[model samples]
Each structure stands twice: as C-alpha cells, then as structure tokens.
Target: MTRRSASTGRWTGSSRCCPLKTRPVCRSQNPRSSNEPLAQGSPASCTAAVPGRERKSRQAGRPDVTKLLVLGAGGQVGWELVRSLQPLGEVVACDRRRADLSEPATLGALVADVKPAVVVNAAAYTAVDRAEQEFDLAQTVNGVAPGILAQAARSAGALFVHYSTDYVFDGSGHEPRKESAPVAPVNAYGRSKRAGEERVAAAGGDWLVLRTSWVYAARGQNFVRTMLRLAAERESLRVVDDQVGAPTSARLIADASAQLIRQALDERSRGSFGSELLHLCAAGETSWHGFAAAILEGWRELAGADSLKLRELAAIPTRDYPTPAARPLNSRLDCTRLEERYDLRLPDWRAGLMLVLAELARKD
Candidate 1:
C-alpha cells in the first residue's frame, strides 16, 4: 500500500518487501513544541529545537541536543532503538513507508533533508533462503542502499551506524572470528551483507559496522518464535546441531547501540571520535539444537508444560536440512574489540533467552 504525506504530497511505496510497519515518531525528551508536526521529506524529519529555550553551552560537560534519524523503525531492533534512543535526543523514526530502502536513489535525499546528527540503519533484507532466488533485490536493499546512506550521512556530517552478520565468514575454523578476520561468504545473503560492510567502510566518515549473529526478540519472525510455534503444533522436532552462534537479543543490541552512540557523541565532543568495526553478540555460544532445547525449556518454565505439544527434540547435522542457501557452521564472532573499547560486558545467551521468554509469557 502507498501512503502520501500531507505536507510533501509524495507517495511512500508499498510494504511488500519490508516486513515491519512504521512506528510513530518518538519524542520522549524532545524540546520541540508538541503540536508541531514532523517535517515533510523523503524519509521524514523531526526537529530538536525548543521555541524559546536557549541552547546550552557544551563546555559544561553536556553534549548539545541533536537530532537522530532511525531507518527501519518497525523492525525488532529498530523498535527498541526508538525507545532506547529517545533519551539521547530527538528521534526521527522511519519504517518502509517513511524511508524505503529498495529505492536507493531516494535515500540520499532522505538523509539530506533530515540532516540528522546520527543515522542508524537497522532495516535489511533478512530472508536467507529467499535471497538465493532474489539476489538482485537483496543486493539492492542490503548492499547498495547502505553505501548511499553512509555517503549521505558523511555529507550531512552525521555518524552512520549499520548492522551486519556473522554469515560473512565461510564457516571454516572452529574458533570465533575477529573483526580483522578474512571474509568469504558462502551464500547470497552473506555476500550482500559483506558488500554492504565494504561499501559503508569505503564511504569513510564517522561510521560503525557491528556484526552480530542469531538475533531474536520477543516480537518479529525469528528462530525462537518459530520454535515456539512449531512446538505447539508438532509432537517432535528436528533442528540442526552443526551450526553454532550466540543468540543475541534485539533489545541488547538496541541498548548497546545507545551506549555506543552516547560514547561516540562524548568522544566527538573531545575530538577523539573515530570510525570502528566491531562484533556485538551474546557472550556464549550454542548449536541450533541446543538453542531450540533451551527455548522449549524456558517456555515450559514460564507457560507450563501443557502449553506445548512438543515431546521429543531431535538433533541432526546441517546436511539433513538442506536449504536454498548454505549456513555457516561456525557463526562465532569474537567481540573483544567491542568489550575493550566500550568497557561493557555482554550477558550469556541463556540469560537473554530467559528474558525474552518471560516477556512472551507476560504477553500471553
């Protein structure tokens, strides 16, 4: 469905490609007048200015209030980012309707019109198997659009933040991969994401590329929710045991991003801000079979055993479950750089799982 902005008289494209719907603009700490509508443009814009309030000096250890633009605002991470980033400054959140990634040409205009201090892109073409048949579409949204956004951010003098995946590595070694590790993607989706990373880096300004693995949330279509649905429908299930990675929560990623953005802003104030590429995920690792088992176990604890029909959970190798794209056997990523630079400690995978399960339980 297409939507036209009342002020711009421009049509926002359909949501056929984008999975998430647009969320309302979040103005938690916004200094702007409550009745003033958001600025009309390609991606939409929100001003941070208060009509009569005087601008504060930065010398008092307080960063200047800035405007932040968040693309993919309807996504799992994007949804949380709207909430998490609200305290930082004025948040202009956009979903596919406000900012369509497939139309790369329009994206530059969106950034230019917004002229935000920070640009966070959480939207992506995440269909792994489908990407094999729709490589061009995936490449356009996941690969091409990011470069344009990064360039726009550079031109606008804004910090660009993008998320990547562990699939960039060809599942060769058993150990976790460092940010410096060589990349050789085995699937189309991975190739597109890798291409995005390369392009973002090539654009070169204040930028950050965070690589994460097995992301999930209380909402959205992810492995955790899929397992829960399947468990209630089937008596037994089979999951691949060969592939392993951390099950990072969208909430964790959002919170960490806020912290990173805050630090980046502080460093910028001190003229020490620099671009970075880091791995961000949960602390530990587990195979898909193990993750499924843990998910069921946690669900049972929260919703009781009768809530699911699942009786047996079978573990099988990757070969037994062939797909349109090959998955990385070793999806591990070493987040030492992130930890050291940010002085943050990531929680274990199970801890994150339980929190999500509890949220789901409360929803029920």
Candidate 2:
C-alpha cells in the first residue's frame, strides 16, 4: 500500500525485503537465478533455444485468416492480442466471465463452435499473491486449459498460440535464460505455468508458447499503472527495487505474437518454428525502479505538468517486502530464436513504456 507519481521518477519511504535467502538476487527477483552472479545491465543475449527448426511454408493456398478465437481476452495481453489480430481475421475473444476454463470440456466445445483459423490463449490466473493459496485454480486456468485448447486446435486444423510467464524458471542463471534452460519454479504460480507449458506442448497442435515478463499496459491493472496511480495519490512509495527484470508492455507482446503467428503460418511449408516455446518481450532489461522512473517521465510529458516533485525513492531487497509467492530474481529470457525465426526486433522496455503511457495519458 503506497503511492507513486506517474509524473515524476521518484518516491519516498520503502517496503520490506524478501524473507528467503535463495541466491544472490537480481533486481527483478524472478524465481530463477536467485543465487547467480548478477549482471549490472540488460541480460546478455543468448543462442536461439527453439528445439526443432527447419523452415517450411504453409499449404500453398492457405487463406488469409478469416476467423480467430482469443481466450482470456480481458487480461492485459489477451486484450491487446484481440485487437491486433483483428486485421488478420474475425476475432472472437473470451474471458472467465464470458467462459469458464475449469470446464475444458466446455472450453473445447466453444473452440469447436468457433472453428477459427487461429487460436490464441491469452487468459491466465495471474494473482501471484493469491495463487499461493489458489494453486488449483492457477493450474486449472493456466495449465489445464491450454492443453485442452491445443487439442481443440489440432482437431480443427488451426494453429494455436499460448502466452506463458517468465516465472517458469528457477532464476539461477546469472545470464539471460534460453528457452531450454532447466526449470525449477520456486512458486506455485510458476509451477502452474510450467505445467501448462508442458501439457500444451505434449498435446502437439502446431503450437507456439511465448513466455513474457513484467507485463503491463496503460489501461490495465499492471505494475506500470499501479505505480502511476500510487504516485498520484501519495508522497512516497516503496517498491521491491532489488528484483530485476524487463518490464514488458502488453502491446508489445500482442504485436510480436501477431507477427510471429503470421510467420509460423507462412512457414508451414518449411517449418522453422512450431510446437516450441519462444520469448516475446522487450529487448533490454531494467529493475522495477528503472521502470517506475520511466513511466513517471512519460506521465509528466502527457499531462503537460512537470511541476510535480517526488521524494527520494528507496530500494531494498525482496526480503524487506514479502509477497505471497517467491518470484525469480532473473526474469530475463533469451529471444534469439524469436528474432531469427520471425525477423522481429523488439525495442527496450523503457521505450515501449513511454509509448504505452503517452497513450494512457491521452485517455486520462
């Protein structure tokens, strides 16, 4: 419970540190690399980790997408993907309110009803704080549902895309993690996401899993928006500054997913990417402190009010401020495969945040 200024890159007071002593932590405190030697800047680039690759084109006469289905349409990433994919086809988006994931029999039935050319699963149970007590629900939506949807996609002869979290890793790597890095999720939420990845992957439905980190959007209830709101209401706020990660905008995920989906469809004839996971977030990385500062800068520009002042923001380790789940210290993921396969080059997080918040300012 703290306040932050979207207009100024500053805060007052601080939160508590993490209680666990895992590894030498990263600024993001992703479950992975909690003990690895820390890198001071963006995670180092790594080799592509897509397990199977050999370029192939889609059926020669593959029609441009005429219909699409997006699950978890209300989530930040799902919301963005639905809008972005509209250009390729008729998008039918669904959230828990509109549909229930626990009843996969029902979800599968719904997919069949749509018979979409492409299926995007963006819905997930993301209450990391609450997930400690709701592991079953997280598994039901984040794990079980994707597997069922993949089956439906396979039966319908449609390509499937699933969104995952960086939480899948144990965060032991000092360097950025490759897609194939051994996973040892420290939290229940991470465990559920990893399970979903494995379940959907085993189902084998011409699928692509894109794992992302620190997801936020201007309109959504994300870190960026939360920090902004806090800044507006109070003089000081405490954030877990030690946790290092790339603050990804949902818009970026949507844009990259759309681009890669198109690439996968086109490569059906020479399948270079499929039934594999990819990393799709911003290019560079930063700590939560850096991200908050950037968002505030954008807010000021948008509001045309730079007069606001902020008290010194304090940074402390995760132990100082505990959450319900154990987050990975290094939330970083390697995107070389994504870059090579889709020819997509994502911008750094700061740049993307500015773009997102500028638009958010207009809305406010």
Q: Using lDDT, give the best candidate's number.
A: 1
Cα RMSD (Å) between model 1 and the true structure?
10.0
For candidate 1, the per-residue lDDT at 92 reads 78
Residue 12 miss distance in model 1 (angstroms): 16
Tens digit of per-residue lDDT, candidate 2, span 89-179 = 5677665444556556677677666666678887666656566787887787777878999988888778888888788888776678889
For candidate 2, give the lDDT of residue 170.
84
Looking at model 1, report the run of 10 residues with the lowest lDDT sum. 12-21
Per-residue lDDT for 220-255 in model 1, tens only? 556777788879988887787888888888888888
| TM agreement with the true structure for every prediction | 0.85, 0.80
Candidate 2's C-alpha runs over 4 A off are 1-65, 269-273, 304-309
Q: Model 1 scores what on Cα lDDT?
A: 0.76
Cα shift from native, residue 102, model 1 (Å): 0.7
lDDT of 2: 0.66
Candidate 1: list runs displaced more than 4 Å. 1-41, 45-64
RMSD of each: 10.0, 12.3
